[model samples]
Target chain A: MKFSVVVFPGSNCDDDAFQAVRSGLGQPVSFVWHGSEDLENADAVILPGGFSYGDYLRTGAIARFSPVMSAVKRFAAGGGLVLGICNGFQILLETGLLPGAMLCNSNLRFICRPVHLRVENASLPFTRSTRVGQVLTIPIAHAEGNYFADERTLAELQRQGRIVFRYCALGGEVTPETNPNGSIDSIAGIANEEGNVIGMMPHPERASDARLGSTDGLYIFRSLLDWFEQMRNAECGVRSQAAVPHSALRTPHSK
Target chain B: MKAKVFVALKRTVLDPQGKTILAALRDLGYADVADVRQGKFFEIGLSDGLGAEQARQQIERIARDVLTNPVIEEFSYQVEP
Candidate 1:
């Protein structure tokens, strides 16, 4: 499947995401400039990490107004898969494609390190390859990755199984110390109610290769591929059945 | 027309920067200061030809939609002719 990675003016990790998808995963991918209004024929879109618009005003406040974002919003509304990482996650929240907002790290410091993420909901397209309660080591780098939502919103997210990943200890224990960003309930990643859009503060692309220290992040990309295959198979099944003529079936001539 | 927009974190949300500032103030011997919360202030100049009510509504919309994120922050605005 073809993938498109968005490149905002201040996007620094665009190359990393491109390399991960194009080289590491052997997928057809292209870069889409933030100024461009079209996403071409990409099946999925990736908003890579970076301080878009120099993180002025807010981390993603300005980047959300970029010309490409309107197209991204439309792509997401059409049920196309969209993944946002780090600053991209911030942009998703700013665009209202996802709920909640990011706050300064509770410690008021930038955190950059490998953290353990528990797969809270493995049924989503992004984590379907992993098992629930599985732990993956992913690197998180950001100053405002602390996710916040009101009580009602948080409750709704939890009830809907939208919380896809959560910070946890290496042994799968959830604790305050394991949460690097002081995010509420240690939430590291979440998917929309429809499970078509996902946003996470951790950089899965940064950990896609074993040479990068760990390859656990590869599961996320692989899961996407698996989901695509499933969808295609389902579509083909419907099409083949529809191609059978009703008159031929009555004569028992249809195979 | 000119407008001043004030953006502040919601009361329920934790303000790490404001907490740090409050601690610094207490450490500097400002014992009487009960609390401190930090916020953002923006000065916007609008073009002429708008009525008072219209200007007020415009500023309110800007403050609510652009100047502040409703998820974790609240905003207020004042317009001047």
Candidate 2:
């Protein structure tokens, strides 16, 4: 599957995502500039981590207005899979594609370290390879990684099993001490209601290779590939001319 | 005309920066300091073509839609003639 990583002006991790998909996953990938409207017929879109627009106004307040974001929003509305990591996640929230917002870490410091993440719901396309309660050692680097949502939104996300990942201890335990950045309920990642759009504070691309000290992040990309393969197989059996197998085109949601 | 907008974190959300500033003030001998809440300020200049009401409406929309994140923040703005 072809993955398009959006490159904003201040984005620093666009190359990391490109390399992760190209060298790490052996998949075709390309960079989509923020000013460009075309996605190059990408099957999936990735908003990589970085301080876009210098994190001015807010983390993603300005980046959300990028010209490419309009295409991303349309792509997402059509149920195309979109993954936002770190600052990308913030942009997703700002775009209202995902619920909630992010805030400065409770400690008010820029933290860059590998942290443990527990798979809260593993049935989604983003986490199908990860088993429920499985611990993933992914690194997160940001000052405004703290996640926040209104009471109703939090309850809804919890009820719908949309909370895909949560910060936890190595033993797969959720505790205050395990919570990095003091994110509400230690939310490390979450998916939209349709499960096609996902945003996470952890930098999965950074940990996708063994040379970087961990390959646990590969599970996410592998899961996407796995889902894409299934959809392609399903599409071939149904219609031969489908360019992109969207969520609506599929029989049932990947969950 | 210029619009002065102030955006502040909602009371329900914790402001770590404000808390740190409060602590710093207390440590610096401002014993009477009770609380602190951090926010953002933006001064937007309006084009001369806009009338008074149009400018107010435009500024209000800008402040709400662009300046502040409604989920964790609230904003107030004033336009000066």
Candidate 3:
């Protein structure tokens, strides 16, 4: 399967995302410039993390009005896989691709550290390879990681099991101390109502290779490749299925 | 004419920077210092016909969607003619 990583003017993590995908999934990938009007023939799209436009006029605010975002929005609407990491998550929220908004970190600092996160709902296409409460060590680098949703929407997220990832401790519960960003209910990542679009705060690409430190991120990218393969064999199209009725999503990369 | 729009987070909303400043003031021996709230100011150039009422509604749109987050910040706009 092929992937496209979006690179905005201030995006510093596109190259890292490309390397992670190539090494983790052993697949073809390319960096799509933010000014590009098309996403090319990519099965999945990744909005990498960075302070685009130097975070002018609010982080992700100007980027949401970028030319490429319109295409990105269309891709996600067409059921194509879309993933936003860290600042990319902020962009997704600004674009309204994902439900909810991100405010400044509770402590109002740019947090950069490895944090534990649990797989809250593995039934989605993104987390199908894990069990609920499955913890993975991933690094989060952002100043706006505090996710906020109204009471009703938050409850709906809890009810639908769309709340995909929650901040956790290495071997303990996620209390206020463990919740570095003070996100409501410690939400680290979440999927849209359709589940194909996922916006997460942690940098999975940073954790994909063991040589780098942890291989926990390998599962999520591997899961995307598996999903593409499944679709190739089933209907031979470029759309993703939101529902994955299985536990521990894993399918060997059928090159 | 020129109109300046000042949008600020309400007092009830939490302002980390303002809190830090307030704390520093307390430690500096300023005992009577009250609360502090941070905000953003914009200078918008409007035509002569754009009065305060019309500008207020438009400024509110920018506040809710761009200038501030309604969930945490309450946006109040004042148009200086």
lDDT of 1: 0.89
- lDDT per residue for candidate 3 within A97-150, as digits (tens), equals 887777778788999999999888887878877777789998999998988887
Tens-digit per-residue lDDT, A147-235, candidate 2 = 99999999999999999999999999999999979898889999999999999999999999999999999999999988888788786
Docking model 1 quality class: medium
Best first by lDDT, ranked = 2, 1, 3
Candidate 2 docks with a DockQ of: 0.92
Candidate 2 chain B superposition, TM-score: 0.93
User: Which candidate, 1 or 2, would have the higher lDDT against the true structure?
Assistant: 2
Pairs clashing in candidate 3? A128-A249, A129-A249
Chain B alone, TM-score, model 1: 0.94
**DockQ-sorted candidate list, best first:** 2, 1, 3
- Give the Cα error of residue A102 in candidate 1, in Å: 0.5
Ten-residue stretch with the least lDDT total in model 2 chain A: A246-255
- Give TM-score values for chain A, per-prediction: 0.92, 0.93, 0.90
> Over the stretch A1-255, how does candidate 1's per-residue lDDT look in tens digits?
778889888998888887787767777777888988888677889999999999988889998999999999999999999999999999999999999999999999999999999999999888999999999999999999999999999999999999999999999999998999889999999999899999999999999888999888889888997787778769777523232111110111111
What is the C-alpha interface RMSD of model 3? 2.3
